[model samples]
Target: MSKVFLSAKLPAATTKILTDHGLTVSVYAGEGLISHAELLKSVVDVDYLITPLSTQVDAAVIDAAPKLKLIANFGAGFNNIDAAYAKTKGIQVTNTPAVSTNSVAEVTVGLMLALSHRIVEGDAQMRTSGFPGWAPLYFLGSEIAGKTLGIVGFGNIGREVARKARALAVNVQYWQPHRLTDPEERSLGVQYVEFADLVQTSDFISINAPQKPDNHHQFSAAVFKEMKATAFLINVGRGPIVDEAALLTALQQGVIGGAALDVYEHEPQVTAGLEKLNNVILTPHIGNATVEARAAMGTIVANNVVLLEQGHNAKFIVNA
Candidate 1:
């Protein structure tokens, strides 16, 4: 049987699909993300390597896998995998795109509402001190019904977010590297705005961009300063998209109103002082944490492995 190594355990259904096809699947032992050293060792003999974005599949990992023919990533983003380097070695890389579009977009909107309404903070307060029946000024939070929402990346997830935000009566504006056609803009009910204008004018700014050289620390001190003091920042995208140090400063100085973050610049290990603040809500990366999405990604990973092994290109091949 051809060997397949998984850096992390995906849904059982996905694993079964691969195993049923007569492929041996080995998942890393123990909990949490597989350590760097272990991952390198595990890939040395595998024909197909399945990994999460947290694991780095660079030149070293690619070089170690002498029999590696395919690198099937479990998530939409393939930044962790060195696809270009893999191409030189004739090893293809594929990611499960669009599977998490609705899931991530749903989390983005949930984060927006959580921050706007201080849901997490309020819950904590109630648990600790108990809410006294009904007080007029106990916890006054902003409403999202009539606010402007600026989406950073107007891709599938961003468009889904726009569609949801419109249902809430929130005015939607988007800023992207490439503007959509006028007709597409009208259909989506979004107005294209300059990046600077979007940051300055929006009541809530959501970062939905991918990790790119130009997008690193895109939300820094200067950008946060330009945000309306009463505005909130929501990030469900790549962590490095926002500068952690600068965000801390902004929260401390009241540079912006508040922030709700799903991803962080340094993931799993959060930046210091983020949890202590009362104005911010931090979450483990749950953008695509739903069972449905994970199961779908598992299926996609299975398909990528089976198809690539059978001399067929995966539908989501990153290096075809």
Candidate 2:
């Protein structure tokens, strides 16, 4: 039987898929991330390793598992694993994509609404100090219906956001490295623009891009300055894509109207002073936290393992 090591806890249905296929699986049942030393020791004799996206499976971790054939990530993004190094080591890297598309897209829109409408602020006020009572200008907030929403990285999640935002009468525009064909844009009811135009013209901006070397700190102070004074920023994508220090500065100085982040520049460690700001809403990376998305990710990850064990090319393989 092929031996597998799961680095974190997952849904029982996910493990069942492996055991039912006659694979031996050992899972780390701890409350937090598995330590690097523990991970290095666990993979010594394992053939397949499954891990959460937050866990770093770097070159050292890849080297620790000489017999490892696959690294199945339990999230849509695969940047946690070093695919280039894994390919050299003849290890297949796979991620569960599209499984979290709807969930993440929904959360993206939710963040937009929460930030624009002062939903979180109002809720906090009600809980902490009691309601101040209603007045025309008591809790002024923006509406989504007439504002232009710019989405960065027009992939599955981005496209979904466009569809949903359009239903709310939002003028949705998008920018990615490659421009979509006219027909594709028309079908999605979105307009394709350059990155500069998207940042400058949008009333609200959403980041759904992946973490690539080129994308690290892509949203810098200069970029923030280009945005409208009343514009809002929402990031449901990778954290490192936006420089938190710069973002904090922007938020503090009113460089932009407001901002919301589900992911941070550093995992588990948020930049200081962000929580103290009323203009920003910070959520623990919960873009894919929905029950449906988590379950679906588990299923997709389990299916990939089964496929690889059967000597077939697994689905969503990032490394050849």
Candidate 3:
């Protein structure tokens, strides 16, 4: 039997799918992401490894696992892996894409609505001081209808967000490395604009782009300065793409209206004073945390392992 090591716990059904095929699976038994030491120990003698976004499958891991043939990521993005290095070592990498599209898009729109309407703050006020009454001027929340939403990436999640945002009567414009054709734009009801124009004119700015060297910290102090004071910033992607310090300064100085983040620049650690602010909403990276999405991701990971074992092409290989 081939030895498979799962870096962290997966849905039991997902584990069952692998076990049913007679693969010997070694799983991390504790809570949360497995520690670096544990991951190093676990990879020493495995045939395949499954990882979550929080776990980094670097060169060290590859070197440790001389028998490893596959690294299956449980998320859409494989940025956590050292793909180039893995390819040189003859280890294939794969990720479960599109499975979290609707899950993330739902959270994106929810954050937009929650931030715009002061939902979290309102809930806090109600629980602590109690609402005096339904006063019109008490908690003046902005209406999302008839507003412009600028998406930074026009990928699966971005398109899904656009579709849902349109249902709420929001005009969607996007800026990506590539532009969509007239027909595609018409089909998705989105307009392609330059990054500058999207930032300057949007009523809300949503970051959906992946983190890259050139684009890392792309939403820094300089970019925040160009946004409307009333425009909210929404991030449902990688945290490092936005400079947390710049974002903190922007919110404190009113450079932008407000912000909501599902992912932080520092994973599991939010910047100081961000949580204290009434204008910002923070989530613990639950973009694709739905039960359905996770189960599907687990299945994909297991299937990738099975496909490789059978000498067939995996479904979503990142570094072919």
Candidate 4:
């Protein structure tokens, strides 16, 4: 039986599958995130490593695990893992993609609605008894109907968001490196525009792009300035894609209306300035945290490890 190091606690279903397969699963059993030193100690002499996006499985950590054959990530984003280095060591890397797409897309849309309608502000006012009386023009907000929704990256999750927005009667536009054909665009009810045009024309921008070298700091002060003053931004994708400092300035200077972020640039340690803004809706990177989504992701991770150990192809191999 192969030895598996479960860096983060997984669902009971995942644990059963690994144990049923006769793999010796060693869990950290810690209350919070496992530290680098702890992870190094846990992964030593382990045949497989199952971890989350928060875990940093870098070269140093990998070097400590001489027996590691596979690194199974709990989510779609493997930005936390060093894929190139893992490949060099003849170690397979896998991510659980497609499992949490709809759940995350739904959260992105929910954030957009909350920001557009000022739901958080209304709740705060009601809680503090600030709503003395209702007026005809009280708590004015923009409607989602007939508004242009520009998606930065049109991947599976982005496409799912578009479909949901269309059901709400929204005009969808997308910008990616590769342009879709006219027929494909018609089917998705989206048009591919240049990055600058998407920023300038979109009434609401939802970022669903991956975090890559070219996309780092993609939304800077210049990009924010290009947007319409009434436009809102929503990010359900990776953090560092948007410059937090630039986003703060945009909200402060009224360059853009507001933003709803599920992920942040620094993550877990959001900038102090952003916390002061009531116009922004922030979540601690819980986009794909639904019970169903987490279970599905965990199952995928477990199956990937099993497949790799059995010398079969995993469902979503990052190195491939």
Candidates in order have lDDT scores of: 0.92, 0.92, 0.93, 0.91
lDDT, candidate 2, 1-320, per-residue tens? 89989999888999999999999999987768899888888999999999998788999999989999999999888988899999998999999988899988999999889988999998999889988678888889989998999999999999999999999999999999999999999999999889999999999999999989999999999999999999999999899999999999998999999999999899889999999999899999888898888899999888888998998989888877
Tell me how far the alpha carbon of residue 236 in candidate 2 is from the true structure, in angstroms, after superposition.
0.7
lDDT of 3 by residue, 46-161 (tens): 99999998899889889989999999999998888999999999999999999999999999999999999999999999999998898767899988999999999889999999
Cα RMSDs, all models:
0.9, 1.0, 0.9, 1.0
lDDT per residue as tens, model 1, 186-237: 9989999999999999999998888899999999999999999999999998
Cα lDDT of candidate 4 equals: 0.91
> So what's the TM-score on candidate 4?
0.98
Q: What are the TM-scores, per candidate, against the unseen true structure?
A: 0.98, 0.98, 0.98, 0.98
Per-residue error at 105 for model 2, in Å?
0.6
Once superposed on the true structure, which residue ranges of model 3 sit more than 4 Å away at CA? none
Checking candidate 3 for backbone clashes, the offending pairs are none
Candidate 4, position 40, lDDT: 85
Clashing pairs in 1: none
**Clash pairs, model 4 backbone:** none
The clash tally of candidate 2 reads 0
